[model samples]
Target: MVKLLFLLVAISFVLLFSLTDFSGESPKHGESMMSVHLPDFRLIPTTGASGPESFVFDISGDGPYTGLSDGRIVKWLANDSRWIDFAVTTSTREGCEGPHEHQRTEHVCGRPLGLAFDKSTGDLYIADAYMGLLKVGPEGGLATRELDEPLRFTNSLDIDPRTGVVYFTDSSSVYQRRNYIGAMMSGDKTGRLMKYDPNTKQVTTLLSNLAFANGVVLSQNGDYILVVETATCRILRYWLNDTSSTTTPESRGNYEFFAERLPGFPDNIKRSPRGGYWVGLNTKHSKLTKFAMSNAWLGRAALGLPVDWMKVHSYWVKYKGNGMAVRLSEGSGVISEVFEGKNGNKWMSISEVEEKDATLWVGSVNTPFAGMYKI
Candidate 1:
């Protein structure tokens, strides 16, 4: 009994000491932790109205763009903050229910992850984790599924105006969004980067075997597609029009690494209207924690322990810096420093946030207030 007591004390001391070293390393260049301040937008329930997940600004200089959890899309008037439901992601009428099916019923809403405006069609393309890739009319009406069997775990989507093609990523082909942590614990590469042709109605795999493919975007020139490998703290580029590279075999697709190592695991990537790309880091990268997460054997063992037992040995990771946006083209894609969470600033789970016109609206997974920001 005395030996067990001494062992517990020793373990606790070591664990506490280790946590002291787990501070945020550094903010990306030219970035500082700022408080987020947002407007007070009344939270409207989805049963009677649309459940907005994020917000975007109108490209035509009209107003704010809001995305809903029930799969409905809306346009918000910034002057008054009044919202009008424009499109619904799913027509189930039953709404989103259960882990397997996430469609909208009268009472619930389907999960709509990412939203983007296409310059060519002037329409909205959304990536629904369960329902696949969807497009809403310019006027924001009913949503139509473009790809039937979109890779599971579809998170973000971006369009190249030049090629008229859409690019997106699946975080894990083997796991649903709810089970991604388990997928990472398995150390399996089920993630993939995919492209869809609007004309042919065909979706092709551009890259595969990613650790956790998360966000995707097109270069300013539309020459390459950049995707985020979240679990691995890396970003990959798929060349669209490059003629010089023969490093990749035909079977594996002609994609090559555009950028490999990022400061953190990027979530949703967006091309800034001003310049550069904005990437949301799921969580601040921790060298010690990541080393353990990367080892499936060790992770499984730790996770298998009892809840209380695990708690005794567990370490809590608080992300000092919530997330940030970066410019890859300039200076070989130097990312901005981490954006701290505060008033008027953006928060995590930004894929759920909407960006239209100049306002950036985001809904939180576990936050006191949902976001309504002017970018």
Candidate 2:
């Protein structure tokens, strides 16, 4: 009996060691401040709306059109100071009434994410997490689904100003937005960067097998595209002038590494009028979480655990309610400035940043209000 007990103890020790290989190193906290200052902010409340992940203006520059949790694309009317319903991505409205319904019925209600405007046509393009890429006319109502065949998680997008061609990212081919946490822990590399031509309706794969491809933005001259791989914490650039076309899934375009070892997982990137780009850091990276993710078996086991318990173990959850944004110089990829939220006024999970009229408009996926800060 003693020998049997000793064997069991040894087995337990080995299993525990395998499951709990946490790196003692901690993730670097963002630098407190440098050249950027936290501007004065006011929250624009979206009545019964949640998760305004992105924002775009019409050709007239009259709106900050955004998609809410209830699958409705709404426009903030400056005259009225309220959000008016503009378009619906999904026709089925059953059980899609409240702000939190998306947590349960996203597949049914549609969770629209990225929003971009075709400046020439005055049409709005949407990246719905569940319904795929969609377009709505300037006079919005029901959005027309453009591409749904090869997408699982349609995350963010940008449209070329001159050609009107749309570029977007599929966060994961294996996991939907609802299971995003699972996709992150699983080390999903099936994400992709794709382009859609409105004229031909042809969808072309620009790059594939990305590590959770998240944001996409076209260069100022439209010569190249920048895509963020959130899982690897890196940015990749794909040259549009490359005439060579390869059909491989791993390598699809003339791609080059742009930025890596980011302090946080970048969510969305937008062009800044100051000859640079604004990147929103969803949350600061955690070394413990990175260590946990290195082991697939441990990640799978953690998924089986209770969600409340899992939240405690998540790095994002540990650093919730903190905000960080970085400004990178154009082409050079130099860190120009950093913007952080003030104490007691944290802007949690900022997914999009838009600069207009000397003010920065910030949108969050987990907050009820959109923030506006004058620079």
In candidate 1, what are the lDDT values of residues 12-118, reduced to their tens digit?
43564366343334655565443455343334333333334444554575645655544556665657656666777777645343232232232234456667777
User: Whose TM-score is greatest here?
Assistant: 2
In order, the Cα lDDT scores of the candidates are: 0.59, 0.77
| Highest-lDDT candidate | 2
> Hey, what RMSD does candidate 2 come out at?
5.7
Q: What is the Cα-based lDDT of residue 132 in candidate 1?
A: 76
**Residue 329 in candidate 1 has what lDDT?**
41
**Backbone clashes under 3 angstroms, per model:** 33, 0
Cα error of candidate 2 at position 131, Å:
0.6
lDDT score, candidate 1, position 126: 83
Whole-model alpha-carbon lDDT for candidate 2: 0.77
What is residue 163's positional error in candidate 1, in angstroms?
3.8
Q: Which residue runs of candidate 1 sit more than 4 Å off their true CA positions?
A: 1-22, 28-55, 95-109, 244-256, 302-331, 342-375
> What are the per-model C-alpha RMSD values against the true structure?
6.3, 5.7
